[model samples]
Structures are given as structure tokens and as C-alpha cells.
Target chain A: MRPDRPTADEMLEAVEEFLRDKVMPAVTGHLNFHARVAANVIASVRREIGQSPYIEADQRERLMQLLGHDGDWETLNRELCEDIRAGKTDLDDPALLEHLRQVAVENLGVDNPKYSAYARLKE
Target chain B: MAGGSIDAALEAATRKYLSATGIADLKRLSAGASQETWSFDAPTADGLQELILRRAPGGVPESRSTAIGQVREARLIQICHSHGVKAPNVRYVLQPEDGLGVGFVMDRVAGETLAPRVLRDDLYADARTKMAGQSGEAAASIHNVPMGELDFLEEITPLQQWQNTWNAYEKYFLEWSPSPVFDYALRWLKERVPARDRVTLVHGDFRNGNIIWGPEGLRTILDWEIAHFGDPMEDLAWICINSWRFGNIDKPVGGFGRREDMFEGYEKVSGIKVDPERVKFWEIFGSLRWGITCRSMAFTHLTGHDRSVERPAIGRRSSECEADLMILLGRN
Candidate 1:
């Protein structure tokens, strides 16, 4: 995997730059709109690839402490959902609120850091 | 309708209905999964008329259970227009003889519906200043439509709406892209379902993008597909949803003005004191509802119902709603 000069993220950046600087300017109508969206999508994927490992590790640690147990990422998340839906968790609990806030903010950092709410919070 | 040319049929039908010699410049504008919009002009006894046709493509039935079908949507506009709501003017509904399936023809109102242009463009500065108050007044008028004439619409209780959306979201996203934020918001909403004593017509999708405006101000309210009978506060809060605000997040009323101005506008028209608490509750609900809608859109991509890149991109927006929920719930 390390045998290449252009890495995954770099390749994605090249594609995104090409779309924005070249392809987008060369297109019109529906294709123009979709080209912009495609460029944004590539950017989003680059962000997700760079950020997911750290974010997921943080989320797993928080979920484990909140639930007081150990499990895989998907299972732990599912259990948390069930607990909240079943009224097992207190909505007003400070720890729970902090955990939810941190998760929302971190995921938003990967998904769309420029979102108004996320950007305002980051500011 | 199947074997015949749709263009010829449409022209023939408009000629008889509008007393026109012919129709010209007929063009398809856009097509959603269930419906098609077309624009054309007719030279008639009354002079040239600019019109829009909203119809199901090839007579395909509506897929969304929540939509009040095209026929009923047109009638609702006619009723609201009769009540001075600035709704679109319906010229006529396509008859069976027209072979055009279920649809209606209406005069095309000139205005802007795009949010960014309306919010930031210099052309709409005056309109942007007046939009929130006008939107509030229009919503008030819509909520005041007499109940006797609305038997055709469904009356959805708050719990019914919440449960149906939650169930559908759970079915689609539980195994795919679960959101703990959504679960938390759902519980928060369930525990605080506001008690309602007044049920009125809720323009289920009233927002900036659904409205038509110009420099002079609001022209016409469009898109009645999801109109129903529900809490009036739902309409008030829906316009304030963060997603509708575009980038002007500070301006909560459709990214144009303050909520107080909108509330004032509603009170002046409806003679009823607006409740801020109920509006906040529905505002949170609106955010969660949109989050669920984003999940559903993503599901369309996953399940191959629609494989467009836009679907997954919208799915990414669910996190935006989650971030919005955190802020709304004071967790931020």
C-alpha cells in the first residue's frame, strides 16, 4: 500500500481540484450542478477518511464509559439507542448530554464542518 | 393516453378549455419521482396566458402516503385563494377526456423560490425584509380556512405523526446508519408532546423554498401536496427550521427576519396569542423530522430505489440535523 507516490487522499484531492477548476467550468445546466455536488462529495470523502478513525475511537470510549461495559462499535451504538428509546437513560443527565453533544459535534466535523450549527459551535 | 401523443392531446385540451387557437412554447420543466411540471403559453380570448402544468408522469399514482393527491392539492389552492391567502390561481383540472392523467393547470406566478437568491441577492432585499411577516400572515390565513370545507384532508395528531415517522426511520436506518441523536430527540419529544386544543389546517411544508416572492414582496404560496389538518404551531415552527435558514443562521425566520416579527404578524391576522413554548417544541420536532427525511433519502440510495449521488449527499446532511438537535436541546 505504501508503494505509491500519490496516496488515497492526494488522489481524491486531485480529482476534486480537477472537477472544481476544470470540469465544472466546462459543463452547463444539470451537469454543472451535479459536478459541483460531485466535487463536494469527493471533499467530504477525503475528510471522512482522515477523521473517522480518531472520531470513532473517541465515540467508542465515551459509549463504553456511559454504558459501563465493552462491546463492538455497532453493537454498543445499538444498545445506546435502545436504552434511550426504552426510557432507561435520563434525558437530563449531564454526562449523557455531554456525550451526545460531543458525538454530534465530532461527527459533524467529518460530515459537514461548514454547517451553520457546527461552524457556529466551533467558533 | 397510452398510444396517443401526449403533446397533441395536451394542446387540444388547452385549446378547448381556454378558448385558445393554439398553445406554444410547451416545455417540460422538471420531473420528480412521482410528478412532472411543464410550462407553456396559450393565446386565448383573454390574451396570452403563462401557465404551468403539474401532473403525474404517464398517470403514475402518487407514491408518498403523506401527499394529498394532485387533484386535492389544486382544490386546496382554489379554496385558499378564495379566502385571500395569496395561493396560486387554478385555471382548471385535467378531465378524463383530456387523457393527461391526474393533474391541474394554473397561471404561472412570477417570483423567486430559491433560498440563497432570496436571502442574499440585492434584487430581493425589500422582499427579504417583508418575507417573514408576510409568511406569518399567509400561514395564519391558511390555518383559518373553515374546517367544514376540509373534510377531504387527513387530521393527524401529534403522536400519530411522531410515531409514524419514528417507525419508518427505525425500519430504514437502524441497521444501516443509526443516529443516537435521533433516538435522544425522539424521547425528548415524546415526553414533552404539547397539549393542543385547536386543530387547524397545517401547510405541512411551509418554508422559504416553498414560497414565491419578488421585490414587491410575497406573491403566491406554492406546493400544497402535503397540506393537512394539524396543530397551527407546526406551521409556525416549520418555517424556523435551521435547514431552511440556508447560511443565515442568526435570522431564524426563514433566514430573513426575527421570530418576534413573524409572531406579531400571526397575532395581528389570527387574533390569537402565539405561544413561544409550543413553537419551540415543534421547532425541535421539525429538525428531527427533517433528519428522518434525510435518512429516508439515504435509504433510497442504499436500497437502489434511487441511486443518485444526491441521495447519499443528503444522507450526510442528517448529521447537520443532529448538530441542530444538540443546539436546540441546550446540549451545545
Candidate 2:
């Protein structure tokens, strides 16, 4: 006898129902540990999806265009990360900080007052 | 209990306790990085009651407590509560025979202690007005706590505290990452260590997040794990650290009120004027201390004892401490 195959949405619904009803109830040892497990699972999924070359190339192009950078995007990201890790580049650096502010505003789809204030501080 | 193995032990303990008093439902609460906190519902023959249980994880830093055992923490909490400090009322200390490892049960107070919400929530919009007044009063109350009354507390000379902290940081750095920034900060700190004026019972983690705020105002001060005998200014300086200021760097006291207001509040109650220069010295120490703590967390992850993204994120916050160093050194 063959087993029935569920649609994608149905499978997702079934998994959600199982987690809410059966799985979560049994795993009550430590709340923080359980939350960490859930977060790690989600993070792993995000990492797997983020590793696609097409997605990476698209993200890089978007970032470079936003920053108005002609150099390689990966190198720019590495430099930015290094700068942030060290105390050398303040989040208040004018040109780069302004570009970051614009990106955040556009991504969030809101004219956030906090970002505006942050941009002004950078200036 | 869903897990049947521990159920028998729980039942046995419950029965033993029930002979004296009824044991209500046990609900596990949020555990901190090193401790497990649980809310125990205790029902007497009369009614439902709630108590908090704190248990230590197997491996933790030696600096967390001066003594080797968990009973010391329970005793300290009890002493703090008895001294009229707004702290949890410790009820019972669980011995080793209690099936549960080492732990203590205390009366749980209702309040918010999370940092971000305390800083940004509209519910606490008026916190900016009241925080300085509350912190001042709380600090005065904590400082007024007579050290001689507590037999369990160790008395150390005020000046020895600097050496003790320096030694702890040195050990912590050797165990973790040996960042040059920490070395620079330590060198600067040793040169800048001020003369001690007076020693008081210091709440080593005395800051915005450690205090619980409720509808009744400040209900209880939490986390006495790092409590020690030190200069009173250490508490004041810990409160002024930029990390505890949340995102609002404007207000020095938990980013809620002016430094002058906090000073005036403490001065009025304690009858001792705060030394600005002395507080600044401790404030620098606060940054260095926190930076070391971040490194220790990273060590926990690297050693394969525990792995969490949050730990590494906390390690990344050492840069903030470096920024604080720059600000303190007049380089920013």
C-alpha cells in the first residue's frame, strides 16, 4: 500500500499543528534551551537559503548600487565588517552612514524618525 | 511530570514537603546564562502561594560567587531582604539531599527588569522622570545596609578591591581572548585608581536592568551574585556605564535622568556628597570589567561547553567598551 502525498501548504499546516500540539508540550525541560533550539533551526534554514549564488549576486549588486561603490561588493562588505569590528569607523561616518540610513529606510518601507536623527548625527 | 524518570523523585520530595505543607504546581521560568530560575506554586492547606527557585548550571565562572556553595547566595538574599533592601524574600534553601542539585526558593516579586523595554517602552515613558529619584533612593538604601550585621559577608579593605578586580580580569583574559584594548584599559585604570574614601556594602551589578520596576514603583533589586564590600562609588559608577544607558546616551543614570539629579538624590538621603572624579574612575573600570565579561562569554562558546550566537554577539559588544575607552581617554 502506498502512502498519501500532501501538498506543500498542507504539509506545512500539519507540521505547525504537530509542533503546537504534540511536540512543544513534551519538550518542557528548560524554556531557554528549547527557544535556543528553535532559533538555531531557523538560523540554519536562513543560512542555507542565503548561500545561493543567485541570491548572493543579487544582494551584492543591490548593496553596491545603494552604496554607490564601483569596487567588488564582497571586498566592500569585508572592509565594512572589519571597520565595525574595530573602533576605527564610527557608525557616524558621513557618506557610508548616510547610505546605510537610506538602505534601512527603503527596506523598512517607512520614513523612520530614528533613522533621520541617526543620519543627521552622521552629518 | 511528562518525563516519568524524574517524576518519582519529584513525587517523593513533594510528599515529604506535603507532610509539613502542600506542594503546588511547579512551572519552570526563564533561566539566565548561568542559572536556572523556576516559579514554584506552593499551596498550603489554606491557599495558593508562589515561590521562585534559582539553580546554578554545572559549570560557571568562579567570580560569580565568593563562596563555593549555593547556600551563600540564599543567605545573602535573605540578609539583603532583612536589611530593608528591596530584594526577594528568601524562604527555603534546598540541601543536597533534596533530589534537586543545589538551589534556593524565594518569594517572587512582579516587575519588569529587561533593559530594552525599560528604556524604550511607552508604558514607561514617565520612567525618565522617576528613574533618577528611584535609583538615588535605592542606592542610598543599599549603601546604608550595615555590613557588620551580615556575618556571612567577607570584609576586605577598600583599596584591595582594585587589586582583586585586576587579578580577576587578568585571569579572565588569560582564560579567554587577550585583547590589547583590555591591556590598554587595565594600564590606564591602574594609573587612574583613586584613593578610597569609605567602604560600603556594594551591589556590584547595581544598574538600571538589575532593579525591577512595577506599578508600585521599584519592587526589588535583583542579581546579588556579584555583591561585595567595596567603595560606595563603585555602585554609582556602575550605574553610569554607557552600556546600561540603553540607546539614550544623554541621561547618565540608565539614560533616564541627569547625573546631577542622581547625585543630589543620593546626597540628600545618604548625607554624603558624591565625588565626580572618583565616580569617573569607576565608570572607566565598569567598561573594562564588562569587556572582560564579554570575553569570558566568548570563551564559553569556544571551549565547546556551550554554543550560542548570543554569546558571540555579546563578545562583539567589546567594541562598544573600546569606544567607551576612547571617550574616557579623550580620544573620541
lDDT, each prediction: 0.87, 0.63
lDDT of 2 by residue, B8-119 (tens): 4443454465432545556666546566676656665655656676767531323454533456777877777887878788867766677666767777787788878777
lDDT by residue for model 1 (B120-179), tens = 899998777888888888889999999789789998888887888788777867867578
Model 2, residue B41: what's the lDDT?
Answer: 63
Candidate number with greatest DockQ: 1
Instruction: Give a tens-digit lDDT track for model 1, residues A19-114.
Output: 999999999987888888888889999999888888888888989999999988778988998999999998899888888888888888888888
Stretch of 10 with least lDDT, candidate 1 chain B: B1-10
- Candidate 1 matches the true fold with a TM-score of 0.96
The DockQ-based CAPRI class assigned to model 1 is medium
Alpha-carbon lDDT of model 1: 0.87
Residue B241 in model 2: lDDT: 85
| Candidate 1: residue A5 lDDT (0-100) | 71
Off by over 4 Å in 1: A1-3, B1-5
TM-score against native, each model: 0.96, 0.68
